[model samples]
Target: MFKPDGNYPLQLHGFLRDQNKIWTLSRENYEALKNVQTHTFDVEGNVVKVQFNPARMTSTSAKVDAASISTRRCFLCRENRPPEQNDFHLDEDFYVLVNPYPIFPEHFTIPLKEHLPQLIEGRIMELVRITSELTDEYVVFYNGPKCGASAPDHFHFQAGNKDFLPVFEKGGIKKEKSIWTKSLFSAEVSGIDDGLRKYILIESGSPESITAVFTHFDQAYRDFRDDDTEPLYNLVCARDGDNFRLLVLLREKHRPSYYFAEGLGQILLSPASVDVCGVCITPRQEDFYKVKEEIIKEIFNEVFISSDQLKKLEEII
Candidate 1:
């Protein structure tokens, strides 16, 4: 039975108390959080924070090929979950659980009830609602399957403590470029094309308007990809007061060839949604120490749509 007067975060707190294993991992996270190495890089004037965390090696080094993924059992599914793991049911089809390998002060992984492929079709608003419910404290983000998701077979969204990302800390847009239209026929849109990174910020005080804008933007992105399915992108949605703010980062590729390069030149790093949006993750100690600003700029250039292509998409939108 669904608990009538319960909150998901509070429920997770209780579960952590009862589940010693998860509780211990959560405690370990506190220690890892302290040891995290931080470096600030200036990319042609825009700043990005680079973090070296040894604990993230699993995600950074994970092989996401179809055969590798198929050989392994799904971890997010209830039947495959750890015996000590517990979750708070958000509804009939989703559950909220503490992320053991956390990247934030407090993190969560919300997975669908059914086993499904990692596709974001028809689910943009759920990202809005989750961010709305966790407003002011958490930011809900979606990672495209080919972009960063290790479990690309399972549909999910990650919630992390707010203000940790450099994009949020930067506050309002800087050096705003006038490339994309600020209005999509009816709804309001803001474009931050400072050349540092192309961003399409959509805002609406009402969910209905927000939904329409997101749908329209998604359709534009799909058309740009020239396909009938999910396009490559990273989305971060946050709700404030009566307004919903959605930031879309368009992508062109998954990982650069440098990632697969031979030793000394090879830096074992994989740029994900989080990585692309200014908080690059370095899972290995050596790479973290050796990574440079020019390298960071190159990675962004490789993963993101070129300025020329971005302008083309803007014209199309």
Candidate 2:
């Protein structure tokens, strides 16, 4: 159902597009989202309200008691072992499991077996190296913990048949460089663009190119982010003849639990089932455009762990 005026409540704004969800935010609501602020807005005749809740950063929504970790059945570690029916082994520490809700017929996940923290470092390099060696025609990617990884506790990566991600197929890679001499490149994705940040398309035909891209990004990661932190991100790399198309996403956060609780989240982000398989469900248009923004705010509020937990995560990272 479209908002009567095609606008969101003032407190909720911005759109989130995944394979199943695409949402638009009202300009007024988008403006209310400062680091710590609460605002209300009109939704049709009713006033639907939203707030930037920082309790997540200040408090623990649910305790991660000792039992949680030991009892944790990490799919990347347990169910993925020995390779499921639609899956195959990629390497010793990594395996390719078919995306249960495939956005494309041959979508797969290349997840690491260990319950390592999901961050770009030595582990990601290994994943990039392996994927490069395995095939020249696949798209390989990683969605950072705050970006799209629902299983933030497990370290894994994903891939899909080249045609699934239109953003990659449609754009061409362009080289870039930071002031510090770190080299990088990007391709533009049309549907979404944040003028302040440059989103680009990318591809890797050789391990060297993949390595270069990852290495450069890793360096940029180090350069752009605080030495003590990570900026949420997502990636897509495709092959185009002798070259490749890649999409690198530097994002702010993930969708909220409501997106997952309601299936419509998937329909809005049509074209990418990754979120469906990983987190929320999106079944239709309103869910995509309306609920996505509300949930994003919710996700931001919910996942902001306490300083103690953040410190622990930092120590491990």
Candidate 3:
């Protein structure tokens, strides 16, 4: 059902090149990336990269509310996709396509062939497997429906160059940095509260073990939140040799108050997997310039689950 010609990165290289030759919107957006401005702020030692990418205004300002979503066609659906856009089948159920609006140098949107809600309850293993297949070249991430996903009506995963997100870099989530650690289903699970963000990390060489632990944690989180819907969170998975490191960034809100603020106080920042990971994107140059260490800390504190909640989750899980 999918190409057997080359590995993912190789196939993606060709796919991107071919798409750029034909897809005007994608080509133009990518070309616009050359002028994107970026700066860094150190929030309690954690470096947060703030990018001024105007092309991302579409996604940054997207309305994923049920009412709003109902009125629009699903952009991820094969029939609804732009005519010039093309896809590389990953499997019978998924297709990999270059992201027209990008934050990473190499970015892709992998969508399920079938139209489905954005949920990750039983799909942790699929994410792990895809991360493994992509090897060390890319990191795969999932934005929970209410977390950061624009297409809340469709199921998908995004992949980007692994080096772009600082959470995977040194000084980010070492075992020693974890506030607490436990072993479940042969996987090592660590809970971290890095002053600004509260997240859970699961590490294991065995995909089965990782999947089992994730399932266990997912239920616990759902129960703790007392919500039927999937818990609000953003997940990042990267393959480390035979082991997979999954970072589940817990969330309390989708967008911070600054996002809805009026006039000069408004900041179009949205915290997603990539944003929470250290690279925050602002589609407006003014917002990017307005962001500072205090703002970063405040935004993170507002969106992420509180230390009390994380402690409770640690005990429950």
Question: Which residue pairs clash in candidate 3?
Answer: none
Candidate 1 C-alpha lDDT tens digits along 1-317:
11235455566556544554556766686568777888998776666888887778888888888999999999889999877678767776678777777777667788988889888877886777777766656778888888788889999888876677776665434535647656764556766665567767777776566667878878887887788777777888876666777777777777877798997888878987678667788878788887888888888888777777766765656
Q: Which stretches of candidate 1 lie over 4 Å from their true place?
A: 1-22
Instruction: Please identify which of the two predictions, 2 or 3, would achieve the higher lDDT against the true structure.
Output: 3
Q: What would the TM-score be for candidate 3 when compared with the true structure?
A: 0.97
Error of 2 at 291 (Å): 8.3
Worst 10-residue lDDT window for candidate 2 reads 8-17
Ordered by TM-score, highest first, the candidates read 3, 1, 2
List model 2 lDDT by residue over 1-317, tens digit each: 11123221110111111211221221222232233332333221122223232222211122224355457565666654433233344556875554443333344567776668777666544654544443444567777665655456778787755443333333222233211122233322221222112343334444355556655555655554555466655665544445544455544434434434645433222111233222232333244345434443344344332223322322221
User: lDDT (0-100) at residue 304 of candidate 3?
Assistant: 92
State each model's C-alpha RMSD to the native.
3.0, 15.7, 2.0
Clashes of 2: 38
Error of 1 at 185 (Å): 6.6
Winner on lDDT between 1 and 3 is 3
Q: Please, what is the TM-score per model?
A: 0.90, 0.51, 0.97
**Which lDDT tens digits does candidate 3 get at residues 252-282?**
9999999999999999998899999999999
Model 2 TM: 0.51
lDDT of 3: 0.89
Q: Which lDDT values do the candidates have, in the order given?
A: 0.75, 0.42, 0.89
